[model samples]
Target: MSVNIDLEITVTGPLDAEQAERIADALNDVAQDEGIQHDISFVVDEWEGRIEVVGGTEYPLIITRFGQWQPTFESRVHGAVQAVALAAKADIKWGYPDDED
Candidate 1:
């Protein structure tokens, strides 16, 4: 995609430790299926940029772009995040300042 995107994931409400773990697991599973290369286990400060996780203990499922931007890869990652949110039954949102949608 030619457009710039800021893809960051954050929990919507009060996310307890247990729920966070489930979200992590779900994200991992979906990421694996989507063939994501970067380590989304946590916030990779080395990425070009990162969005801060607001109020709570930072949750791990962050998907950061590593190299040349690939729209299909990012699209799959977004889809994976959506899948994780559905599986965990949690309210998760992805996208940042530059995102149009």
Candidate 2:
């Protein structure tokens, strides 16, 4: 049996455009460093699986993993998200059932 998961990550806290860009950059860098293939995007409008990043920390940025993934792949993504959160100086909250710290 294949172990798969869907991760919805939200990093909360005050953020300007520059900070948001930095977060995205850090995520990409971590993904590259760990050799994890992913498609990550920042949106200003509501997406299918997420809401828009409005002003204030209440509607902060969100990062999500779609489809199925192996446990190892899930671990890599979790690590990468941690790095991104640290670099962005933000708080990470795992959404729904995949909540881990």
Candidate 3:
């Protein structure tokens, strides 16, 4: 059976280019370690030095994949994101749909 997981990571910032690359690298590492194939994509907007209320004050980076994954994959991904967030001094919000949903 195949499973498709849709993942989104929202970074609240004023992030510099280097910081953004670090986050992307961390997430990619997770995908590599899991031995899962992923087509990664990102959305970035110029930080205006102020949060915009219209979009909940965050920049979103999204990842999507359809394939088999190990049972511990999600946890590992979360940890990687968290570590990157801490180092980058940015806040992160992420989620994936429940398997049953």
The Cα local distance difference test for each model comes to 0.40, 0.40, 0.45
Query: Top model by TM-score, which number?
Result: 3
Among all candidates shown, the one with the greatest lDDT: 3
Candidate 2 ranges beyond 4 A from true positions: 39-101
lDDT value for model 3: 0.45
Winner on TM-score between 1 and 3 is 3
Q: lDDT by residue for model 3 over 1-101, one digit each (tens)?
A: 33344444445445566655665567666655654334443334345663211111122223344333433555665566566555333333333445446
What TM-score fits each model? 0.37, 0.40, 0.44
Which model, 1 or 2, shows the larger TM-score?
A: 2
Tens digit of lDDT per residue, candidate 2, span 1-101? 32223334344444455555555555555445644424333233234543323212222223334323334445654464455444323323323333444
Instruction: Name the runs in model 1 displaced over 4 angstroms.
Output: 1-6, 37-39, 42-101
Question: Per-residue error at 90 for model 1, in Å?
Answer: 6.9
Off by over 4 Å in 3: 41-71, 87-101
Q: Can you write out model 1's per-residue Cα lDDT over 5-88, one digit (the tens) per residue?
A: 333444333344454455555555554665542534422121224222221112333335634444665455445444534432
Candidate 1: RMSD over Cα atoms? 10.1
C-alpha RMSD by candidate, in order: 10.1, 9.8, 7.7
